[model samples]
Target chain A: SQQGEEDPQALSIQEGENATMNCSYKTSINNLQWYRQNSGRGLVHLILIRSNEREKHSGRLRVTLDTSKKSSSLLITASRAADTASYFCATVGFMDMGRRALTFGSGTRLQVQP
Target chain B: DAGITQSPRHKVTETGTPVTLRCHQTENHRYMYWYRQDPGHGLRLIHYSYGVKDTDKGEVSDGYSVSRSKTEDFLLTLESATSSQTSVYFCATQAGGQGETQYFGPGTRLLVL
Candidate 1:
């Protein structure tokens, strides 16, 4: 079962517009990671924000994590058509259990039109 | 793309038949995982292996089983295929322990009819 739930099930935007996706989890986590899955492709790691860190950025991608609220958000500035994909947030809990390795969110489908 | 690869990228099988999917990796990572993806269910772990001859069940392990006879190969087996088991299966590997970044393979598309 998925540990995180993503909001805005689907989004459509122009190439230059910004895209934002939100994820909420139920328990504490060691870190929160974002991944992108292109159509008919495997998942690619994006950015990882530790529980101790409030915000982190990598190029056009920005991620913010709020442990108090148990939520995280990924923001992509100046989105491009290449950015069109399904975005998922995976939560890593404190347990070192391999079975509980990564609980991914339902994901948000973003379509960036050129 | 990681050093991981899943064999038989696409497969179509009949119900009640036994099917096996293979995940091979060149990285020699210690941890390997098997997950199935469906329309509403994002990704659910079916099983994982920490090392050779060492495997464990995941949340959705009811219909599946796994085996790791060697470090670089992990195999997932469906004792009896069903229509509901038709989904894209992904294989992932992490270098170290839990919480480490997982590298995913291209995935295998399985259709059970």
Candidate 2:
């Protein structure tokens, strides 16, 4: 079952704009990670924010995690046409019997118009 | 990506037929996972392996079975395929660690008629 829910199932914006997508999960998480998938391709890891971390940045990507709210958001600044893809939020939930696995959310499809 | 590969990138089979999908990784990551993606459902874990011959069931494991006989190969088999089993399957690997990054393979599209 999906543990996270991404807001705005789809988004479209012009190049040079910024795109922000939000994800909310129901259970306590050990960490949250974001991934991007190009059409017909495998997912690529973007960034990971630990439950104790409030924010992290990699290149033009920024991620924020609020454990208190059980939510996370991914921000892409200066979006480009090549950034068009689907974005997913996955959470590593609390361990059960010394094991943990990621629960993915329904992805947010972003379209960057050139 | 990340030295991960899924075989038979695309396959079509009739219902009730047995089908197996293979995931091979060169990195020898200690953790391997199988997931199925369907429209509106995102990705649902089918099974995972923590080591050779150490496997665990995921949320959607009722009709599927997984085998990990070697460090680099994990196989997912559907003993009797159903039309509802059609999906794009992905294999992911994570180095042994907590909250580590997971690398994904190019997914296989399966269509069960």
Candidate 3:
């Protein structure tokens, strides 16, 4: 079952512009994570924000999590052509019952035009 | 990058046949998970192993089974493959601590006809 739902299923942006993706989950989560997947490739970990943390940053990537709202967002600054890929938000809910499995969203597809 | 690799990156099988996918990790992570991805369903967890010989079912584990005989190897098996099982399968590993980052393998594309 999918716990998170990402908004703006698809987005097109010019190079150097910023891209933001939002994810809303239904249940309480231990933490939220963002992953990037290129065409015909595996997923790469971007950043993780714990329930207690509101914001996290790594290089050009920024992630914000709001436990109260049960939502999270991923923002990429100065997007490049190489940044064109699918972004997915995964939630590790508190009710995993020790399984700690990640439930992923449908994902947001971003296309950065050069 | 984490040293994770999945064997038989691509496989084609017939319905009612049994198939197994292998995931090998050199990092020796304590946790391993198997997930299947389809067009509309981003990714759905099939099974996961917390430690050697310790495994549990996920939300979509009805048609799948998993085994982790060693810390570095986890295998997912479909007892009787079906056309609906055709999809890309991914394996992930996570270290100790809850809600930690998980590293993914390249994935295996399976086709059941």
Candidate 4:
């Protein structure tokens, strides 16, 4: 079962624009991370924000987490054509049994035009 | 890149045959995970290991089994391959610490006919 759900199944934007993707999860999480995947390749970690932190920035990527709403968002500032890829959000949850695993969302496919 | 590599980048196997995919990491990360990607289903975890000999099943672990006999190696085996098992498999490793990031392997495209 996928605990995380990302809004906007697909997004198309022009270069130099900002692309924002949102994700929501069902359970309490220890941390949330965003990843980017190119065609036919594996995922690359973009940024990770802990449950206690509301926002974080890493170079061109910005991530925000809202524990109250069980949601998070990824913002790619000044996007470029090379940023065209599928973005996914993963949530790491801790259940009562102490078991933990990362649950990924359906993902948002972003296309950046030059 | 965390020095992770997956074997048999692409494979086509017949139904009922057993298939195994190998994930190797040189980073010596303590956490390793196996996931499958399919159309409309972003990515689903199959199994993960926190350390050597410590493995656990994920959401889609019915037809798959994983082994982690060594720190650098994690193997995922399909007991009986089926058409539904055709998908791209990815392996990820994470350093054991707070705010650790996961590094992923290229991926293995498997097709079961």
- TM-score per candidate for chain A alone: 0.95, 0.96, 0.97, 0.95
Q: After superposition, how far is residue A99 of candidate 2 from its true place, in Å?
A: 2.9
**Top candidate, metric lDDT:** 2
For candidate 4, give the lDDT of residue A37: 95
Query: What is candidate 1's CA lDDT for residue B53?
Result: 93
lDDT (C-alpha) at residue B73 in model 3: 97
For model 1, state the Cα shift of residue A93 in Å.
1.3
State in Å the error of residue A11, model 4: 0.5
Q: Tell me the RMSD of model 3 versus the true structure.
A: 1.2
Pick by TM-score: which candidate is best?
A: 2
Residues A35-74, candidate 4, lDDT per residue (tens digit)?
A: 9999988999888888899999999998999999999999
TM-score of each: 0.96, 0.98, 0.97, 0.96
In candidate 4 the C-alpha lDDT for residue B23 amounts to 99
lDDT of each: 0.91, 0.93, 0.92, 0.91
lDDT of 4 by residue, B36-69 (tens): 9987788888999999999998889999999999
Q: Is the docking of candidate 4 incorrect, acceptable, medium or high quality?
A: medium
Q: Judged by DockQ relative to the true structure, which candidate is superior, 3 or 4? A: 3
Candidate 1 local lDDT, B7-97, one digit each (tens): 9899999999999999999998888999989987788888888889989888899999999999999999999999999999999998874
The model with the greater lDDT, 1 or 3, is: 3
Ranking under DockQ, best-scoring first?
2, 3, 1, 4
**Which interface RMSD values do the candidates have, in the order shown?**
1.4, 0.9, 1.1, 1.5
How does the DockQ of candidate 4 come out? 0.70
Top-scoring candidate (DockQ):
2
